[model samples]
Target: MKVINLFALLFLLGCVVSCSQPESGITNESIAIIPLPDSYELKPGTFYITGQSSIGIDTSDAEMAALANYFNEKISDATGFSLPVGNSGTIVFQLGDYKELGEEGYRLSVLADKLVLNAYKHHGIFNGIQSVLQLLPAEIKSKEIQAHTTWSINCVEITDTPQFAWRGLMLDVSRHFFTKQEVKRFIDQMAEYKYNVFHWHLTDDQGWRLEVKSLPRLTSVGAWRAARVGNWWEREPQLPTDSLSYGGYYTAEDIREIVEYAQQRYVTIVPEIDIPGHSMAALSAYPEISCTGGPFQVNVGNTFYTKTENSLCAGNERTFEMLDSVFTEVTRLFPSPYIHIGGDECYKGFWEKCPKCKMRMQKEHLKNTEELQSYFVKRVADMIRKKGKQVIGWDEILEGGLAPEAIVMSWRGVKGGIEAAKQGHSVIMTPTDHCYLDFYQGDPIVEPNTYSMLRLQGCYKYQLVPDSVDASLIMGGQGNLWTESVPHYRQVEYMVWPRALAISETLWSDAQSRNWKFFVHRVEQQFRRFDLSGVNYARSIYDPIILPHLDKENRLKIELQTEVEGLNLFYTFDNTIPDVYSNTYTDTLTVPKNASMLRVAAYKGQKQAGRLIDITIEDLKKRAMEPKK
Candidate 1:
């Protein structure tokens, strides 16, 4: 074995200290084959980076100066190209011409020791910077301290690009409010992870978070609400006394600014205007839309209100007129090609009891409640398509027969996507089991216990393609962060990162290029990045679980070895977080009532490590955690 230098190794160790690792070394080849170091010597010159003319810079923009200063610092730290006042360095990067290079836009080439990073857009440049950051040492990327003079390049040539057209993260701003700066910070994180789509859930039952100039009440009355009492489904009903209160929405200007910023990072902001269901916020603003026209108030404190009979307002030309106007403003605000018309869990009990709905069903010769949902969805889809946009909805949109030219977001599972795909419709696979970011990764007790079934490893191991199906039907995948309990920016970041990073690589990196070991290394590196950026990610306790190897007879066992202190193992074959004091290690764990998936978590004092096991257990305790469910 080669004897490594002590101080350098110690420094590197410090860099990776807090990011505890699996004692067993990484076995993946991609991670095992890092280029050996040749030399660390300093000799460089001037470097220049430019953007497309649309950016309009002439060495006068302060941000340009800042960008230059940042690169200057990086060069000094990594390649020892320190210059005094007027020394023009040997390296120069001319950045410009921002445009989408299809899917293969990311490219970097070193010609005669001069590194050139090129993309059609500034966002491409940002992605290039992220790749370069990965190439450097963890210490260098973290910049614990910038190097004075010591840099060398050994002829590196790289042409990088994303595999999927859409690598996205959806943040539901309706249940929670994030400040403008906070939204930008999330964008920064997205860019860091090479994510290119930001699915902004702008409205829901809890709040209408976007400002509509035509209707001030969208922000004034609809946006405000009384403090929530408890779980939305189980809160005690307070009397319908007059109490108006709480929260704010994004003004149109605020949204424009946000969109522009995200555009700079090459992230398309797709606004989700929940409809059919999750429309209480909108209904509250316009009582005329409700079947019951009088005294309809926002359902504050999680009280589920009966749907008003005025749902589609059949024959009420006025209702269609209102929707036309509403969507007009919506389309103007969000330029994305596809708009989300939330069509899940509508609880059409009100429709079942409404006279207008009954009459419409009779006149239209519709069969049942599902048909009404289909009718409502199809009309909205028709309306949106007329406005030069396509409509996307939850898998439920597939229930009443899908709308023509509609994209199916398969949240329920791969079945919906598979059905839609076979029909030749585009499908975004966000199966709640593997793509919902809100679900606890491990034992329910350890995580917030989001009703989702996806774990980190499960997410990493998921294949977007359905078995024996055409790959062309797949549009990509998204990890959704639905905020029922999460209320702040810190909580948002905590729930998104690390796990989302895993999804990022799974989506962006080449499938053959993937190595779990390299991914873990990069994850540890990201922890350092998060620390420097002041992001509130979860502790190391909730790591990806490594299953014990099984022998020929299917017997499983492995030595429980770790150097960390105060560690404890608590597991449940059934999905639940194990209590530290509860010494419950049994052969079988029963699936708790109403539970759909099994999970477990490990923890030490104040440090919790849990991951949702992607194992489907019919008998509660007899299933093994598998790579895929």
Candidate 2:
């Protein structure tokens, strides 16, 4: 691809355009940047990138040169200029030892003539580059070279750094496989919001999505599963007649490619092998490692607990050997200092019944199955530690006894996180209520089918560091996107965004600096950018919050509210689609005697801001009778 020069192209425009005033009601506060930066001062003149603009970096330093090239390629798409790293360019990336700004901190000075980004390390420079991109128009994200785009950046003095080091997002690929390209896109989005950790949930009971050379059947058998798609945990069970042909795994080459790609963005790839429990797929491949694991098929999302086994038998020596083989390959494949060993929801029922488990318990002087689970985790932790990688797992690993040198990823709630932090272990506080992106962020009636609700408001308001615990022990938090309900890449974008943005902000920005109203406004601005980039995002929070309540007269009444203010909720009892011209909801509604259904929608100005939602009177009655959330 030929690199376009920015200077010649801008010179063709005949004059330098350097308007510093906020154009068309756009202000500093309205900038749609996710994970908002700490401090910035808007200047009088704008920095219009011209063909003469070049990225200045220490060409002798390979890493700095690479970082400059990354920014060069990004701007080249829109600016029509493949900026080179020379002695001194208008855009400069200077690396130095500025300890006060921290390793991931940067100070940027943008003027009409030049933009200089100074940082203490490579990551800081990279972060400054992202802020610059955000300051520009959204067209910079276009894959194709845009012909008529004005690549103008706001002139400003800015200093920013992350509040937490472990800003991350986890994707569970076992439930629904995503291609390598899709995974790369996911990582790119994470890096956009300054998330540094890519937690790859590689193995689960439903399927295994990683390859181990020594364990051939792990992918050949465990990675493939019978196809079943519906609401997760409600799909049909895999029968003997079912053929396992609807799954895929990442090859060693694919893993390397993704790791290298993530490295370019300063993102770490943390591979997770959910073990002991969620290992039915593995047992399906090697049944001897399980107690009663003969003829176990990869789960088809059907309910299974009493009939089949998922946990690896703690008593089996082959289990450790197989794990060693798996982790040896995993450690070699990923350069991350940490590996996730999922120990959540392990069923110990089979352990109580199996003779081998009892014998192993006696040999180790274990008190109960909980201790047995702990022993399994400790052994796995040791295995991972020997490979020079620390082990991080779900908070369930804290049961009976905490493993040595292990980090706890608290998913159940803050209770487990507090427990882990008090014990002097580093903790990642990703409580389910705040950080589970897979859950429904809107009403199920209007949103895609998914269980539970973790609203964008709830996520944005999450207090990550508990006051009672040692704040230093808190290694920061991340959002987990379990792929149970998310089946494809497009839907993945729909489920993650807006909410993931909330998580990113919570993890990156300080609690005191965050304001809910301001963040929502910024999110609305981001939605416009997403629209420009053709990225899917949920606007369901703007939809009316339909609630069924009983009046004093024992009649079912409907109440509606919206997460966003200024949205006009219009409703109709006659079941016609509601629009702005329809009856406005000023008060609670009484369901008409013969009305079959009620439809509601929210509007801003003349445009439909939220999706239309229909609720049958019968469903409303049923909801009224149910317990309040």
Candidate 3:
């Protein structure tokens, strides 16, 4: 070892003191906290929650007192122990002048006898309380009181802060309506991970999920679609005997309840009202506003018809009138400073052919249909700004030219986000490859059929902020769970978790501090918590991704690798199920002659760890030849 100078030794000792490893009992391997805190030091001992303990808050501050009461209620519901509100107690929350803590950052200290939380804002205090809950037994998340459960927390000091201001999860409810209670539960889970934004995709081609009082037909006609089962993209058209009602929308009162619930958890709901394109539901309610003036019905299927006319009539003044009426009610219901006017996938072919559209193009001296979309987006942005709110749109809003005051939600890819940042507009990075939870996360044979592949590690490994873009303009990132294939809340939970947990840490924790192995360990901890809370989560991380390549002799060879280590992979060239006794995967194996299919599975010791993956030999060869995305 090299000798160190006295000053160097002192600096090293200081680092060791400030950044010590977590104590054994505090950072339990069985229950790791998601979105790991900025700085934490676990001390010996624990803070036991007894019947005598009470929650303390400043009664003068109504907001703080309410938050404290909320925590008390949750604890009481969980552990069968009621914590009364008092001026002094073992668990204390206080607002202090900690300017450095920021709005959503807090300092939490747990001593042997007392647990103290200090923050400058109520949002920070709420977040600190979430951390306290996580520190307790996983049973604390149970709705019913648990018998013989120890309500205690490890003694630790945590000064936690988020890396980004905006950490979000978008739930697309238009395709399949989720109940108000489900939405609240979603928000509650998101809050535990420090996600502050809930991007509600309330409108889409299939259905409209938000009610506009002025536009009665929106809910009356657009909210109900023909019931379709099986694959969403391959569903058959509705017959006369089929049920024409299979959807629901949130009433004004329902919106208020959900919004207030989110506010208490410090989650801002950004409601998305897709326009121009994906307007089939809207046009079904008011067909005169479309380029093709005829009757239309809410779409029950997921196929995007290229020849069909679904976009709004860009040239019609009636289109703007209808939009203004709808938006007027939307702005009143949602208090978010930024309103998402979906500017994505608007097929402009109808506008290119319509007489009114051509006339408007001539009047405005617009070159192409792309410019018409830009015009529509800019007009909507202006209207929304006039209502004291800014506009956020899909990356396509930059097709012809971006509005001067528009924010971009880059979903197609990071390129749009980069361009938006370059153009001096803020961007939220939600590229599909990393953030789209609807994509198939495991072996296509094992998981439900969806679009593309996005492994859990792929999400954890994403670099949200591109180096070329202005980092300041990069607001944050979000994961979107489109529900075309997910008809139930259980499937939604299955697709979002683990992956959402990865995205949460990506947005909240420092990028340099990320370690795949460490994160997976934490994920396993969350799995146990999810089990206790009756939440579904995917465990596809244990599955191995098969990669095929041709050897020097032109013989096809297959390679397999797991995301994490220690899992043994087994394979069979025949159409037989793989077991512990099957051929162990080590080096690349030659494609056996006369073998039509290959099956593979992973095992931890003697138990099967992941779903069995089966692939046809022809498909394997094609995959080998295709370039990786």
Candidate 4:
């Protein structure tokens, strides 16, 4: 045993205080794996993980070796031992021919004496180990060694094969740049959920996050902007005298390191150098590429619509020259099969007005600005394909015509994806209503302010493949965390989790086996793991959904419902805060005759489980005027 220092002692005390409180009342008898396995069977016994246990694997395989080491590192906090690999061990990992199970599929059997894991590829091993981690007690994720505790998993046989190939999460680093370490932490959590892709939105109107070594200004100028913390599009514009110290960019070495880090977890980092539209950062760096050249600053959240500098000058030869340089450098850094060229929201009015654009359109025999955009997209696609890569764009890429061999990321809605699939183009569906994580997942009054609401149920309930489209053309969907309002990493975690878990299951687990009630139970299990892991997660599901409405007499009436079953909603109309002792909501009720306000809260048993919603009677009337479904 090692001597415990003061710092370690305090940390253990903190973890102990938290670990004492388990997250849910759900029974441990069931195996609760998120993005639930394709099939599993509960057996009669349990496999206990003790100090004597060792992790077995073929160390000769570098991937397995790293995975084994990672697994050991993670569990070491609780077990207090480095389990040797490829030796006598209770846990064993083996890779063999499992074509039926697919590349990321695995088979695991945990018995009394020993546990065996079999997978065809390293990615399968990576995913299999995550399930193993979940099997252990939540305390196993603690930062300190757990003494007098049994780190055991139930005896079971699990066969998991993802139904979708592109299980992914897109982190928009452009709106708010997360540090390289933070990005790694995000990927680590995504990998644990069996997500195979990390779509990195590297550049947008707000900032450029990746360095193009040849085009130094892309970082020196484009990657920075004046700080503004109010509403995203309502912030005051950046002034010339303001200090541009709010942003940062990833260097070439940093990009390489992050990419390799993701690769180790079997995650492909798809870089999105968003262009044509959302190109204000690039335009700010090199104003020569815009229709109205010179004097363009990196956007400061305020809408710069019709300014015409937000989009790249599609007709300029210099724009292609700049893009070629950036694309060449991008291809050099990332080895992903596809690169995202943002062709969404490009204001064509500027293209229609520019002399260079008119000349190019005439030369190319194009009719409208949409065809001009198509020409630019086709050209950009050709440039990328020449570098041995495919192009991916927002649904707007379908605007004149989608480039040949291009992948469409349908952000507007499924309509675009369906159209793309019908046109024989691959589509990654990230429709804003369901897949946009940046939207408020809970009641916006208490949740972070955002444009829309995408509740966990809404995301989980969505059918990924629209029956109208050819299923083969639909790759998968991702939860896009566009961070205009998420200013830090913890907020990022809070926004992503629980909801992102819903996305993972929708994309990986077989649709037939997906159960909403059971999935909520699994989410509760994950909450405990996150608690022990020091990861931030939202408790919004426990919050009551408050809906204001007009009575037959046009009186103020409100309805409150909890998403998680059994969470009691308490309300008070007398201007006092509500607790567990307050009046419970059983049915619809109108505001009191002279009550000035209504305060509602949610509680699990005697403990507060959600944010308190306070609404003035006047505000309730306003909400009732525009009732939400």
User: Which tens-of-lDDT digit does each residue in 1-629 have in candidate 4?
Assistant: 22111111111111100111112332332556777787776676778777788888777777788888877766665566667787447899889999898899999988878889899988898898878877765343343535666666767888999988998999999999899888988887898788999999999989998888889999999999999998888999998799999999999999999999889889999999887888889988898998988678888899888764688887789999999999999999999998988888888778877999999999999999999999999999999999999999999999998899899998887999999999999999989888999989888788888978889998898788998889999899899998999999999999998899999999998887767776787787777666655678998998888888887888777898988787899999999999988899999977888998888899988999889988788987887897474
Model 2 C-alpha lDDT per residue in residues 1-629, reported as the tens digit of each score: 32112211211111111222222233345355667777666778778777767877788889998888777766554566677678689999998878888878899899988999999999999888777766775344343545556567667787888889999999999998999988988888788778999999999988889999999999999999888877777888887888888999999999999999999889999999998899988999999999986778888888898668889999989899999999999999999999999999999999899889999999999999999999999999998898999999999999989999899999988999999999999999999899999888887887777767888999999998898899999989999999888888888889888899899999988787677776787787677566655567888788778888888888998889999878899999887888878999999898878999999989988999888888889899988988876
lDDT of 3 by residue, 317-395 (tens): 9999888988898888988898999989889888988998999899999999999999999999999999999999999
Model 2 lDDT, residue 327, Cα: 96
In model 2, the clashing pairs are 4-81, 6-50, 6-51, 7-50, 7-51, 7-52
In model 2, which range of ten residues has the least summed lDDT? 7-16
Candidate 4, superposed: residue stretches over 4 Å from native: 1-29, 138-145, 627-629
Clashes of each: 33, 6, 0, 0
Question: Model-by-model lDDT, in order?
Answer: 0.61, 0.83, 0.83, 0.83
Which lDDT tens digits does candidate 1 get at residues 1-629? 11111111111211111111222343321221111111111223322221110122235545433444444443343333433311123333335553444333545553443555666544555565555444443344434343432232233444456667778899998877778877877876676567888998888877889887877887787787766645545655435664656567888898888888786556788888777777677777887765556455555545555633214344234556777777888899887887888888776777777677788788878899789788888888999999999998988898878899899889887998899989889888888777787876654445663554455566676677788767877888888999876767888877887678777866775665555555555565556645654568875334334334344665443222221233555554445555565433333333445555544445656455444334444322232334434
Candidate 3: global Cα-lDDT?
Answer: 0.83
